[model samples]
Every structure is written in structure tokens, then in C-alpha cells.
Target: MGGSGWRKAIRGFNLCVYSPLAAEGGGDVGPPGASYDPPAALSPPDPPALQLPTPTQSSSGLRPRVSASGSGLSKRTCAICLTTMTPGQGHAIFTAECSHSFHFHCITSCVKFGNHVCPVCRAKWKEIPFHVSSDSPRARSRVNPVNMNRRHAHMSFQHPLLHNLEPCIFNDDETLDTTFKTSGVCYNGSINTVEIKTYPEYSAIPESISTDNFTILIHLKAPLGPRNEISSKNVYVDAEDSRTHRAPVDIVTVLDVSGSMSGMKLALLKQAMGFVIQNLGPLDRLSVIAFSSTARRLFPLSRMSEFGRQEAFQAVNSLTTSGGTNITEGLRKGAKVIEERKEKNPVCSIILLSDGQDTYLLSPTLHNGQHTQPDYRSLVPSSIRDRTVHNVPVHVFGFGSDHDSISMHSISETSGGTFSFIEGEGAIQDAFAQCIGGLLSVVVQEMQVRLECLHHNVQLGCIKSGRYASWVTDGRRSGTIDAGDLYADEERDYLVSVNVPPDHHETHLLRVSCVYSDPVTKEVINPAAVELKISRPELVGSQTMSIEVDRQRNRLQAAEAMAEARASAEHGELSEAVRLLEDCRKRIFESEAAKSGDQLCASLDAELKEMQARMVDRQHYEAMGRAYVLSGLSSHLCQRATTRGDSTNSGSFTQTYQTPSMVDMLQRSQTFSPATRQSNSKMRHTLSFPARPKPR
Candidate 1:
């Protein structure tokens, strides 16, 4: 009852509203002596300005303290610590590698404590400028870098970190061979239809006035996914080593004139020797080591000329097979000949040819009163490989599939040399010529190609670019392909499976980088990059792939498949290997990627014929596998050899190995001609972009 009485009394109690509108006489909203008015009639006082909490940044990984875009110097705020770059606030700098702009103090702090990688792209960050040669020609778009952190108005040319560094691979020699050649799996004869892009969305620009860096070409073929499907991107990075500088080569041919090479083999050897002699420039030197029961230097290293060449021809022909095969003696004498020029540091090569295993060996025979160095390890078929490890290279060719491949292969592999196998009875000559071609194809001494994936969607499977390449490395973010010694106008293809993004537009994917040591100067070259872009079917009306790309892609895929097939065949799966090639042919046939189906079909038929030989004869298979591995080239690669005779008879098949012919490109301009398509006339096309304010 008491609680109910208190509630009733509280309800009956009177109260006055307290607001700005309250009046003196109990509640009509008005000021004293003025008309009553509501608080809404008066302008609402602005609420206290909203204050946001400061965001936090974790300090674990590389985080950029700078932004990507900017205005004039000091006109922007620092992205790191929420401070402007105006006047006393700080100054800023831009890195071309990642194209990120940052305040001096903030970026310095980031570099010192925030790890060395770029915040945006996470690329290796360097503080110094490119340090281009003052005498070097600069691009019209290039501007002198500004130093905004300092008070001085002048530019400093002294970049201590990069000073005295020579142009690792810069040249203006337009006469270098630029023709892009390939063994056709699709289009052949000329590279006319190949579309080259410096970057997607840019027109093809000719390299008239250019920088001295390596030229990189990107061939993109983005297919239209089956209606409304987001299409995947297909890109190929084609890099050309345009710097042409000839270095002197000193060669020592170790020929096996054993009894097995008495007739056709001897004649082929003579022909192969003649071919080598014919291709040698006057500056090049050659020495022959004829080995039978005994090894002797037929002639010391001699300069080739009309008269000298004649004498060499007579000397090579003079070699007649009689005694047992002494391969160890041949290698020993050959190494001695090249080791003679170790001090001169000439490009030394030891080319060994043998048809049978080493059958005889005396301690170390004297050739022209000089004992063979180190006695070829005093063994049947062994040599001191250390000499050829760096300065000289030992290339071995097993003829007729009877030679000890284990011994010959080990010799070449240890010496950074190439090992090739010539099958059948009389193909030794062709094999020799091909060996010589490969020997002469040394442009970059120590070369490595890296594919850095720019986007997370794409990656590559690393494969050895050549048998001569040391090794292929798989990295966390990139694939490193070992490209041993690149030849003049020699194009090597690699197949990498790209995981396409789930249908995106305006996507940029991979970056190809080349690092090599120049043979002429021995300078380590690095930082060559090619940005790859693709045209998605969604962006373009029709999906069309040029003959050049179409053929190369097919060849690359086929080559990779053949490689797997060869491996499978070696494991006793002959049908699997043949199936690989068949599958490749079927795909090409269905797609109509080949310019001439008959030509490609003929090539396939020839390929299948060889592969079928491997299936029937284990010896043939071993020979083919050994050669394929040594060449580190595709199945379509038959340029070094010319075959004649029935494919079934290994003895009847004759091969003459020779370097591929090169097409010279004289001029590159806007003019259109059939010759331009065939030759290496690299017409550069400029990229399109809106004009921007010039930088100081």
C-alpha cells in the first residue's frame, strides 16, 4: 500500500521543462520580454569537429613510407608519419626500379629499419642513380634526376656506389645480327608475322636512336575464352643479345682415326674437317689431334688462310685409320694444345670424336717432341678436366653409338662442354659440323635468364635453356633458366605453364630479366627487364595469334612434351613417348596453328620416324636421347645435321653438322618490304601516353 501511495504522489507532482525556449510564465518557449520561440528557429551550433583515431602500422615487413604519385617537390605529405614534405617537413625522392616516391627522412628510416625491398613491388632497392655514362646517348624522355633533399640548385654527378662501373652490355653497333630464327613447328622461312611489343597498348617503335641495353621482345597471344569466359594470357619473352663483338677462337679437334673409321667414316671426318676449315675466319686458329693406336698433333695451332687452309686439308686427309682406338691419348694431346694458350686466355675448345670405346693406351705418347700434359689421368679414356673447367671447354661427340658414353659424357660435363651423339654408320661428318657450329655459338660467356612474375596469378617451370647451361634454379618469386652460351642469331625457346587469373582486364603479369658476363670484357651484366602485357579477349574484339607466336608456342609445347616423352621412353615407355609427339601433332592439326600443314606434318613424320627408330633399337634410342639432352634443344632442331639414306639403317644415315645460316638486316624504318620480314630489321614502335609536366 505504501509503494502504491508514493507512485501516486510522484505522478501528481508538477515539473517545468528546461530548455532555451522556456519562458518566465511556466513553459511557452520565449526569452524574457520577447516573443516565445523554439530552439530549432535559432541556428544550431556546429558540433565539436570530429576527431579520428590514428591508424597503426605493423613493423614486420617492408612498408613504404612514401606514395607512388606526386606533384612538384614538397607539395605532398609523407605517407609514413602523416607529415607534409613542404619546406622544413622534409624532401622526397623517386626510385625508377619500383617507381615509388618517398620523403627523404621517411624513406631513409624505412630503408634502415623497414627492410631493403621496395614497399610497392618488393624489388631489391638501391639508393644510387643508374650512373649512365655522360658520353652515352640519353633518351629524349630522360631527364636529369633532381636532388630535392639538398639546398643546392645544382645536380651531383658523383654517385659513389655506381661510379667507375662500365657499360656492362651497352652498344650502338647496328650491324649486329638481329634476325630471330627458329626450327619450325608452325611458321617457318621468315619471322614476318611475329608481332613484337615493347609494351602492351603501345605501338611498335623502331630502335633508331636507342639505349645500349639488351633488347627484349614480348609476344602475347591472349585467347578468347569460350564466350563470356575470362580468357587466360599467353606470353613469350624473346630477348636478343644485340651486342656483337667477335672474340678470337682457338680450336683443337681430337679426331678418332681408329680402324672402325677406315672408309666412309674417314671420308666423312675429312669432309667435316673441311667444313670447319671453310667457316673459320682468318683470325681463328685450329689444331688437329689425330688419335689411333697413338695420338699425335698433326699440326700445332695455326692461323687459317688460303695456303694454311690447304695445308690443314692435306693434314686431315693424311689421317688413316690403322691401329686400336686410344681415346685417352686424343684428349690428352688436345688439352695440351689448348693449355698452351692458357696465359693468352683465348677462347679454347677441345672437340673430341670417337666411334668406339678406348681399346689401347700407352703411358703418355710424345707429339712432336712434347709430352701430353698430365698423361690424360693415365687411364684408357680419362683426361684432366680441371683445365677446361673455366678457360677451355671440352666438347665430345660419340659416333656410331659404340663409344663409351659414360666416359665421354663425364669429360664434357666436368669441363662445361657439350656432348652430342651421332647415330648410324656414316653420319660422323654431319655430327662434327654441328659440333663446330655449337662451339662458335658462344656470345655470352656466363649467361642466366630469370623470369620474375609481376603478378601472383602467373609462374613458370624452370628448365635448363641448354645442355651446356650449368643448372636451372627455382626461386620463391622467379624462375632462373640457365642459358649457357648464346649463339649468333640462335633462338632458344622455353615453355612455361601460366595460371591465368580468373578473367581480369588490363592485367600485367611477368617480367623477364637477363644477367650475363660479357665474353669480351668479362663485366657482370644485370638488371635487364622486359615488361609483359597481354590483350585479353574481353578487351579485344577478336582473338588472333600471329604465325610467329603461334608456331613458337606450338614448338615450345611440343619440345617440352618431347622432353618428357624421351624421359618416359628411356624408362621403357616407348608408347608414352610416341604418344606425347602424337598428342602434340593432333593439337597442332586441330588448331591449324601451322602456316603449312604439310610442312609441319612432314616435320612430324620425320620426328616420328626418328622416335620410332629409338623404340625398335635401344642403341638408336640411347643415341637420340644422349644427343637430345646434350643439345638441350627441341625435337624439331635438325639444322646442324643433313641426313641422307634410309632412316632404318643407322650406318647409311650420314649427317653433316654445320651452323645455321643468318639473315642480315640492313635497315629498319617505316618502310614495308618482304626483305624486312625475312631479315632482322627491328622496326621499333613508340608507346602512346598523354603528355605530363616535365620533371626538374
Candidate 2:
């Protein structure tokens, strides 16, 4: 049948199947028969008795297995296979730079499969020419074919083929089935086995793995996914080396003193401030600003060494909440303080504590002159409206649910600072401590990731950042180059992840470059010409894992859009509501394409499509209703104007007046109307008015 015929048949099947009872029976006929009587009891059968298997003792009366060495005892387990091993076995086991390790045989098998290193450690080994050495231990230990197969069966019986044999030896149990097996061996000769029905415990290596006698695994898991192996040994030692420079920072603390910020909220803010002050080193300088309708500097900026502890404590304790919230004023004053201190201090930052909203500040006015009335309640001046223009950065900490997170995020984004949301008062100290610790360890002054795509045809999307700019690419047939700046002699590293179209044939190359200012010489340094090549895709099954991730992301997007539509409806934004709903429908459709097996996705696709059609119809009617109202209002306004002119006996009366319909249409089409032209003329005339009369 054709596609249309199949659809019709499916719809007909759905309609016929109304209820389970109706579908099960096609009309009743006769009454049910009587229940059958119990059959006469036959001679009672002999009771089946439980029989236990006789235990057979081995000739030696003990299992023959190698015991773990005393020094080999450890809690380290293979992360991949999750098996516990004795320290000796673990020590004998070789690990690559990537921290992956395995038994010698297992490593050999992995290498034979075009994997050049330990599957778990991901260590790359030098490719040496193959030559048979008579004295080689591996050659001497090679077993005959029969013995090799027997060993393989024994190993398979003791432990599943999936388990890694690096740190533990397996022993076979004749009583248990092939599926049931042991999982771990301890240094004290203790063994643990798990049944097939039980959940497997993943091996977690608590201690750092050693890098020796193994190869690193550099191949990532999948296209644009996380690298399969990273050498733990390659990570920088001496954690202190991560910091490049040490400069004293000048900090300004802006506290909210609104009525709402009383009691626990205010007390916690003070406690957190005290913790920060105590943690500061002698070189740092600090200032305090408290705000509520207006901002007041309670203390001037003072060096950590010279500041009196009594005075600082008094200033924090004396703070009280009153009046309305004026966050804009507080921020402006705090910025000024930072600027004044910038000439003396090399580093300056502002730490703002509040709920993340702008209730204290008025919404910005549009520049269009249609409305000439000015709202003097706005606290943010036109000069410093943008936070990016400021020299100092602002870090925000939100307390309680009442805080506006979007405004806080915007403040952080503009000032190139970090924004953190605190769920409760108890978490205030920890959050403040973490922020202050990060500030003390600040290494790179200005770090940024720059991507230079080799494939010009590919389009780049927006790069997002919290504390630093991290670049990720999302497109087909693209190569990415990530570069960043660092502080002088500051050893810094960034993880650059990029997305590219899955290629199955040709190799793709990504070029990277780095530029930074030298810390000692204070001169700019540039390093370029770093390139990486990605191999072609390897087809796995019917669906690529990337497709699954894409589908999941689409589902999340749909859910978010649905939530936003519901919120917009509550806020009386009908247009925005309808738009969000439409976006949700599109996302659902796109998700269908990524699902495995077209037949399985068919039913869900049909349901989603039907829902979308219904929503579109409803939106259409709603839009028409809105248009009708606008048109009626416009006609009424014009009629009123005409009537007024006629009553005045003006012969030159024209039927033209501003209405909601005209305004909406003009906004939609981005066109100017005759009314707007007249409004502009009036605005120019008003601006040209003579100077205000001098006061007597």
C-alpha cells in the first residue's frame, strides 16, 4: 500500500479499538457453564525430600593459588573493569601515561586490535620492529595450543571476559554455573564473588595511578566527545605551580540593607564578610559599602596590615536594614570606589551580595522620542549603564529564592566576574570562602579562547563562558583551532572541545595557537602552528551515539520551551506564549529524525504531529481575535476624532488617529506610519523650545 493508504488504515484501526471489552468479545451468546467439581484424590504421592550434594575434598585439601604480596595491599581498583587486585599484581601491572593498565595478555589483545596502548591507562608505547628473541621471557612462557585453550577456558570460567585481569588472579569453581563468578582479590588472599543477578560495582581507583611500562590512549571515545584516555601522569605536579603571579587585590564589599534583608539573611551576610576579611593576606586592601535607597561608605579602603580589627568588627555589627532597595546606586558607588583605588592597586574587584533582581532600579527607557516624559526614579545613569565599560569586575552572590538570578547573571557577565546562587543562609560562609580562595589563587589575568576554523563554509555559533571563555563548535565538516592568553610564565591549560560533522573517509585537521604576556619581562609572546588530526568515523550498529545525545538534547529543549510558554501565558504575553509553543512543536519533530528504528518512532511522531496541528489551529483563532479587537479600536478612535473636528466646524478634518492596530502592524512590518511622522515632528518642536524661565 501507499503511504497515505497505510496512514488511513492505521487511523481506522485506532478508531475501531474503543475499549478492551468490545475488542475482546464480538457480542455475547450463551450463559457460562457451572464450575467443575474437584477430582477424586489419587493415592497420596510420597513427599519429595530435599537432597544435598555430597562435598568432594580436593587431594591437597586446599586451593592452589598465588597469594598477594604484603606490600601490594591497596584499595586501588581498575576504573574500567571494577576489579580489586592485590598490590603485587597491581605493581607488576604496567600503566601508560594515560593511567590505563591491564594484565600483560589483556594489553597484548588490546594492542592487536589496533589499540596501541593499555585500554584502561591509555598509554602510548614506542613502535618497535617485530623480532623474535630466543631469550625473551614472553617467548619462553608461550604455552602449547591445547594448554593455551585450556588456560583460556579456565580464565573465562573464573572471571567473565569483560573483566580486566590486571590486578587480580581468577580461580574457577566447579560447583557454580559458568555465568556466576568472582570479581575481586585482596592482598590478604581474600576473594569476593558476585552472582549474575546482583548489580556490578564499578572499580574506582582512589589513589593516583602510576605511569610506567604502558602506552597512553589518545583516541577519544566518539566524535567530538571526551577523550577516552588522559594520562594522569602528565598532569602538572606541585599544585602551587598553577599560579603565575601574586598581586594584592583591592576589594569592595557592597551589602544590601533593604528591609527584606533583615534577620538571618543580614546576620549571615555579616558572618560571611567576617570570614572573607579574616582570610585576606596582609597585602590586600578592603572597603565596605552598605546600601538601601542610597549607598553609604562605612569604611574607607584600608590595607590589611594597617586596618584595625575593632573598627572593622564595629562597622559590620552596626549595619541595620531600613528604607527601600537601591541596588543600582550601591553598584555605582562601589564601581567608583574601585576606580579611585585602581591607580594604587594592580588588581581590583567588587563582591556584591544580594538576591539576583533589580527591584531597586527602574527599567531603562527607550531612546525613541514618542514619549517625552522622563522617569527620575531610575538609579542607573546613562553614562555607566553597561557594566562591561567599567575597569573593575563584579562578582555576585545570591541569597535565598527571592533574589533575581537573571540580573545577577547579567551583572557578572558585564563585569567579567563570577555569579553564584546560594540556596540557604547556612551555605553563605562556604560560598564566600570558595570565592575568596579562588581570588587569592588567581593566576591568569586575561584568558580568552580564539577559534580559527579551517573550513570557511562552516558557520560558528556563540561562545559561552562563566569565568573563562571555552569554545565548542557545532557544525558539519569543520576543524577548530583554540588559542588563549596567559599571565607571564603562568603555566595554564584549558580543555578545548569542538564539534564537527561525522566523517567516515578523509582525515580532518585542527590548528591551535597560543598568545600571552610574559610575567617576568612584561612582553607579549605568541606561539602558533599547533595542529591535531581526527580520524574518520567508525560505524557502530544502526545508530551513532551522537544521535542519541542529539535526541536527548532536543527533548530537553522541547520541555524548556513548553515551560516557558506556560510562564509567558501567566505573564499575559500571548504572542510570546504562542511562539514558544510553536518552537516546542518543531523541536519534537526534529527529535523524531534522530530516533532509532523508524517503525518504533512512528506512533510517537503521529501523536506529536496531531498535538501540533491542534495547537496551530487554536493559535490561529486567537491571533484573529486579537486582530479584530485592534481593528475595532482603531475605527472607534478615528470616528471620535472626526466627530470632534465636525463639532468644531473645521472644514479640513481628516480621518487619521493613532490606534493599537496601526501601532502593532507598524511594529510587525518595521514600517513607519503617518502618525509616527507627525509624532517625530512634535518631538523636534518640543526639543527646540526656549530655555526655561529664570527663577525670581
Best by lDDT: 1
Writing each residue's lDDT as its tens digit, candidate 2 over 497-565 gives 333443444323344444433222334444343444433434322432333334334433443554455
* lDDT of the candidates, in the order given: 0.43, 0.36
Q: Which stretches of candidate 2 lie over 4 Å from their true place?
A: 1-246, 306-310, 342-346, 355-360, 363-391, 404-406, 455-505, 517-529, 536-696
TM-score of each: 0.48, 0.39
lDDT of residue 674 for candidate 1: 17
Distance from true location, Cα of 309 in model 2, Å: 4.6
Give the per-residue lDDT of model 1 (tens digit) for 1-696.
Answer: 110010000000010010011112332111222221111001111111111111222343112122123211232433222223455523444443666555443343334221354432335666533333435453112222221223222322222112123222312111111122221111111111111133221212222221122122233211111110001011111223222234446788888888888655664466456556645544467877888887776655665533234335445534556788888777777766654442332356788888787776534568789975433234422334544335465767777656665566556666656556665543444445445544543445555666666666554433323343433244435666555554444455443433435334444556766666545456665644677755344333333444444554555555566678767776888777778867876776665456455354445435545554555556666655545443433223322232323223442222222223211110001011111122222221111111221232
- lDDT (C-alpha) at residue 197 in model 1: 33
Model 1, runs deviating above 4 Å: 1-245, 305-314, 343-346, 360-388, 391-395, 401-443, 456-475, 497-505, 517-528, 535-588, 591-602, 617-696
For model 2, where is the 10-residue window of minimal lDDT? 4-13
